[model samples]
Target: MELCFGWFLLVASIPAIFAQDISHGSIVVDGTMTVAQTDDNFVCATIDWWPHDKCNYDQCPWHYTSVMNLNLSHPFLAKAIQAFNRLRIRVGGSLQDQVLYDVGNLKSPCHPFQKMKDGLFGFSKGCLHMERWDELNRFFKETGAMVTFGLNALHGRHKIKRSLWGGDWDSSNAQDFMKYTVSKGYQIDSWEFGNELSGNGIGAHVHADQYGKDLVNLRRIINELYKGSQSKPSLVAPGGFYDEEWFVKLLQTSGFGVIDVMSHHMYNLGAGVDPKLVSKILNPDHLNKAAYTFGNLTHIIRRHGPWTSAWVGESGGAYNSGGAHVSNTFVNSFWYLDQLGMASKYHTKVYCRQTLIGGNYGLLNATTFVPNPDYYSGLLWHRLMGKVVLNVESHASPFLRSYAHCSKGRTGVTLLVINLSNQTNFIMNAQNSINLKLAANEQNISRESFTHSLKKTFSWVGTKASDDALLREEYHLTPKDGYLRSRTMVLNGIPLELTSTGDIPSLNPVRVNVKSPITISPLSIAFIVFPNFEAPACG
Candidate 1:
């Protein structure tokens, strides 16, 4: 019903078959696809523990105290965790480098968050109580999240000369923290050193040799402490903006195998609050610029470590906090989903979204911790996409950006086609429509039907189309009010909202027959699932 235009009513009153002759142009697509040789972990999100006081701002909804102690009892979080079974969570941010573990609860007293000119401050000098650390570990275990803890790399180096190589750098505090973690039997998947201290630093800078030395020391400590275990947690370094020469030097000096995951931070879209944020996301050229960085990182990593994987340590689109309304709304998904598609193609093993619950760009709403539009996009991605990345080429207009991957545990491929055009419609050829059965487990609602029916069922079976045609399941993401600029998001015409009890609403997609070629409207995104391709490698 949401797809019907008012003008189409009079036209629909006529014979259903004639309606097909009265519409927009069609763009034929060639579905022949190829799978990449390598496939890495697809999605990784972050839970920022720094600036724990971000909640003090009126625009920020996350309270450091509550987020640090979040438990599985929160249904919203529970559902998200359940969806991404192997979710990777990075647990630190800017303040991490300045923070110290108060083993005895005797560091500086905790202070209220202060609003700095750049962003929120005050996470720099507080002590992380052993109790809070334990609680966070408990929550991680319950959620089955693979944890990557960021350690303080700038601790003793502050107040020292910036050019000095190693005198002020100390690992005693880190050693103590590792010992405590081992004693507590908490398993960390990776331990990252420092926070935004790379290119010219974010208030602090450490030379490549110095940082490499620190990473080597961390590796030694991990080997010594976890020697008896089967596998030790990985050592991640820099955790800052990517500087071509700086990163290459760090990897070379640190030597092969020193860092398991080469991580970097990105805020290429500028500020989330920018008035032209939506325009920027829709621009394919603007979105494609980041590909250079992605390619560069992958090239350097392969050249140096050869074994190390590349990751986007933190990315929230805009910096100095995100855009007020733009980053949090349905419009943001244009950038978010495009990033997901782009990053995976460039061989980024793990892409961590900045702040799981803070600022304006968080996947969950700050106050209620409800699932945002991006959350559902990520959920659908987790459920439908497999590890194998596929190569797909579209002959349609540049506005239609399409990506394909093998369907998760299914025989066919899943295509994610996004329409950036605000006014044009693109159509693809189809043989016969397959009626989708509304299984309770399928997560789609069958009650909401479209007012106008597309029943022409034009058949054009190409050489690519097998005698045994495949069935498709479509999950479309559009604005709640059908406006490209609107913030609210709906899936298959169903608006996603939090229930009265603060629970996650049923994210049921509307099912339809794909008997004929389907039309993709402007400024919308769809995940079309084609089952039974049975690609040899995906299985």
Candidate 2:
């Protein structure tokens, strides 16, 4: 998809405040709040299920042997996996390679195959085979998730030479494990030959040309082995840091048709960088720039061959230590939504967030699977939004940014408005009949700040000691409501009132006789779904 950004404005009004009592506006959506989906209108997260210190490489290993081995018959894990109809699992990391060498009886002395300091088991000497092929097969069968295996491609003994590229580069043990995983009906969507080949800056340095050749050889082998399959797993190469030239050359030499998708990595914040600036990197504007970069790279690839999709295979809001402040807050939701909107606008597909539940950027707290603010946002998105984008137009309003999309069945439309200005008000005018459902709160409110038990007061409503105490207490009290109110506003000679209800106490979508300008408050997000509309329905 082409990624481009442009400013737009809408100015118009109509008559009639329309309302439909039949509840004809019900709409369904998949609102997963995943950056990958935002980047590409597709949502997927990475899964690494290894135990801590179970295999030493880098970072703490995940300790979940029992969890991983749970019976597929159980509904909890199975249901969770099903919710993720389309998921991607990266099977190898530094730790994974360590496990492979120490556990698998690969005969070769590949770089990754060599035993390291404090090795758990003698690699060349052999150790217990810990390959979890059966476990993985059962999991995928139960969850319906796809796998992307990262094979060891380091130099020295592990490097798969031009002639031996098709053959397993690692010892016999590793090859057997690879073949076994594939045989168990596990579908491999993509195979990244190695991890961050360009960024690591060390190991067997394979230039773009070399990498491209190796990729071709791997693809040939995979295709030959699975000849009857209707689709071949994409051969992804250069799994590295951004190198436009290297990527372009690889595409040119390999032929565009040979590759399925181009992959790269991006971390907004790195070591020594100020954490306070983390929000800026995660900001929608910056994410737009990243999308533009993706567009530009895709354009370069298109020059050599037909179009190929792109993916930010690995990325998070932060890198080194994550954002000191903003990574875990409600403000991050803005970043998450903006990223998804921009990515969808550009048509990029398949965004894979770096970590699902670890590190600072994780959706859940590293130790507790309890969701962070970002996770809640993700859950909402996955549960509420649809896959397709809709066309929307907004008038000039510095405080509010809006997006519109029709539901999958074209029965309803969802309009999303985000108010970024801290103190400004936004007035919105609808040119047609529509229904709105809004979710809003003060810009600074924390997830834990409000609970279901607390009663909320609106800025516009007045309170009385009792229903009949208006004259009894002689007290004039401010309204407990927090939303703006309008009465009989005229637009093109039609009347409308900005009203509120119990469901959305902070905001209201009033029926309008004419599409007149409606105001929005600072730092709020609103959604209006139009089930059916006709001109001048209210009048």
Candidate 3:
């Protein structure tokens, strides 16, 4: 149990005693068209710069997980990353703005982060040594990961007030770092500028107009540094909370064709220490609230930065280092997976999780290098779902969150169904949305508003016009021991754990016949792959 705090210990106290009804839901998968598309590398995670002393709620969770000190040689570390053929690893965090790159720099002494009274976020400026950077690049290459480095946007700025940072951004250090990266042939996928310094800012603030102008300079530097290279890393910026007015201004100021990725962050569950963390994670209303941000970002990007796309540069359900027992537990996948589905629906190219290994929000245990429940969730999405997102219409309770995509490198579609209710089980059926019909008791209807009001349990049929019985692959995930805060995850009755040699276990799914409904147990998630689905869009 990593970061074993009491945040969700009482989640089961005063639990429901009465048994609930089993709901019959029909999930209509649109096969003819796609509503949105994501990047091939949609599953992304982050590594932060927090030191051992970066404690929250009197607990020091960030241990040896900073970009500078992570155990790159650890067997599990490499294997976990390698599991995703090419996991998108975003190397950045709050302290990235206070960081100084130690490459071709002779002005100041490069040192590690030190806790200081007057420093930003109470942490003094940290330094990233060139040698360490080289080592990181080597590890990334060995693990076959795509890297997105966050540059220090406050390099030349000074604190003008309590929260305001002023003056022009100094691109010299970042430019030197990029030049060194290019010289060494290090392959970086993207370079993100700044952290949570948008809106009113988190710990520090900056004007959007100035940030935009500095981004122009950054793009120029990227062009100069990688001039002859056939491909250059993309520019992602303003990795912070979504501020409509500020976002509009930044894009207008930067003009078109400047930003490649419009990245933002979120912590919809509020603070990590809140008592109702588990409740918020399970509540459908709370989960759907993030749709506003994602939807608005889609609109804003379309209007102002049409050249760019959206990326959730950083998002941990709870903000301050995340919740100890809540964020690192199996139940957190409800929030994580739902957000992943929602983001893809809004055309988000990449959703960078807050920490791959740091704090309570890490996918891997900060010190043990073991995968958490959300890690399995991410790996499943990367392996099963493809870039083309199809339309899935379900009129079941909001408790059932469903998303469909063309199966990755396979025919048919993959349906992700999450049952958030702790008392009700969802008997889900996947029918083609082409011309879906109701059960025996209901009248025939079109597929536009395809919802099934159950006359008992609705039957599941093949998406194609065939009498052949097909089997779907299902991966059901539930918390170990019915504990929502349990760190261990049980996948299809088998616990997901590394081998004695520290390798990821095989995630094999159970096959069920097409006539059988996809059974989603209470508080469980299922990634059902219909191998024989007649999806014309995927074809």
Candidate 4:
């Protein structure tokens, strides 16, 4: 043996563990998240079809006008203006005649414009209402929200004398209205020629070829009327439902570039709205399914020829008056945020959420003008998240799915995480060291009254009686039902709770060490802000 006494050497390997800690605080960050920019990205809030008419309570009490009037001045509108620069007012419904008359002539009587009385001559009789227009303009100025007006295309109103190429157009009054809007310096960005023209129930039903022909004629009149005007509005056509075949035919026959945006409506009601079916509307997984539908439509339109953009011109969680219970719950916020996020993903520029303050699915409670969970969700997106989309990667779990965006310039990163599981808990670990702030609340804020447990109402954003003065005055209920309470956890500092007065109680932003993990409770929506982090690397 060359070496009789070979020394045995042993090496012990030590595992590398990265130590990290996170901090929490109050003062929820706003407008500090980043999102990716794509050609298809545009933000828009919806103006209900026939908003002026829909908001007139005396005319449509169930639709609620008072709240609509208030929304014109609501801080929420300003927030929306900041977030999305575009808006659409769907113009056909039971209230179509009223809007046409009101927008056409300001002094027109509120009385119903009977088709028998207001034949072709009667349509132009109403005077354009400048007062309401001023009110609308004032809000637009404050928020910088542009408008897309939807034209009423129901068959009997405006008819095409011939086929696609030449037709005696009877839309002089509508043309004048566009002229007036331009004269007033109100920029009508685009005019969608109709509501869901292919749908059978509400409006005039027409085949794809007939609708496409009518659309071409309508475009001609709009172009002829506003040819030299600064407010030349692009004409959109045949707002389709889920009829893909119809959409394909319309795109093929309709001349290219005639329509600025391809529009469609989607409401997922797998079956009827029974108790079991209502839950589907607010389900987070269900939200992703709607995005796939939107994506497919975008691809179909692209296949025809490139258009300016695509928009979910008219959409809500439910089509048949919305669901009973789930539509009003705080859980709906997840659905709303998810829809916006998904629309952004597909590069769909503008998403007009069905009705702002009517229908069971309205973002605001029609009766009180109080903001609903969806409204709060909108407010959060407007205030905190910026337009830029960032690459957010998360470990997938059925219980939790998240999207993250860095605010423009990387001031902060916002993680919008949802816990879909009814009972399972989830933990989120940061891949890098970053500062964090958290705010969370449960989906349900309603409580049974002491007098009658059977009757329940939203106790969070409305008035209620309580023995304590502080509790009685606070509008929103907290985890305690009497006081607003939320905790902020920091890495090495004491956790602080938010007070009923909406102030953070002496909490400071604590630094979180690198590679720390943050845990989330079940059925909660938590917004985490990461400050002082480097911009994520982008290709």
Q: lDDT per prediction?
A: 0.69, 0.45, 0.87, 0.49
The best candidate in terms of TM-score: 3
lDDT by residue (tens digit), candidate 2, 373-464: 55434443443345556444554543345554443333444555555554454554443212221113334555653331111121000111
Name the TM-score of candidate 3. Answer: 0.92
- Give per-residue CA lDDT, model 1, range 430-463, as digits (tens): 3222211112124433443221112222322222
Off by over 4 Å in 1: 1-41, 52-73, 104-123, 160-168, 430-470, 485-487, 499-515
lDDT of 4 at 507: 20
The TM-score obtained by model 4 is 0.65
Give the clash total for candidate 2.
48
Q: What is the C-alpha RMSD of each candidate to the true structure, in Å?
A: 8.3, 15.9, 6.2, 17.1
Task: Compute the lDDT of residue 480 as modeled in candidate 2.
Answer: 16
Which ten residues in a row are the worst by lDDT in model 2?
A: 470-479
Ranking the candidates on lDDT from highest down gives 3, 1, 4, 2
Over 369-478, each residue of candidate 4 has an lDDT whose tens digit, in order, gives 44445654554555445555665554455446565555433464555666665545454554321122111122343553332221111111112212321111001111
Give the clash count for model 3: 0
Q: Given candidate 2, what's the lDDT at residue 216?
A: 70
Candidate 3: residue 148 Cα off by (Å) = 0.2
Total backbone collisions for each predicted model: 10, 48, 0, 31
For candidate 2, what is the TM-score? 0.62
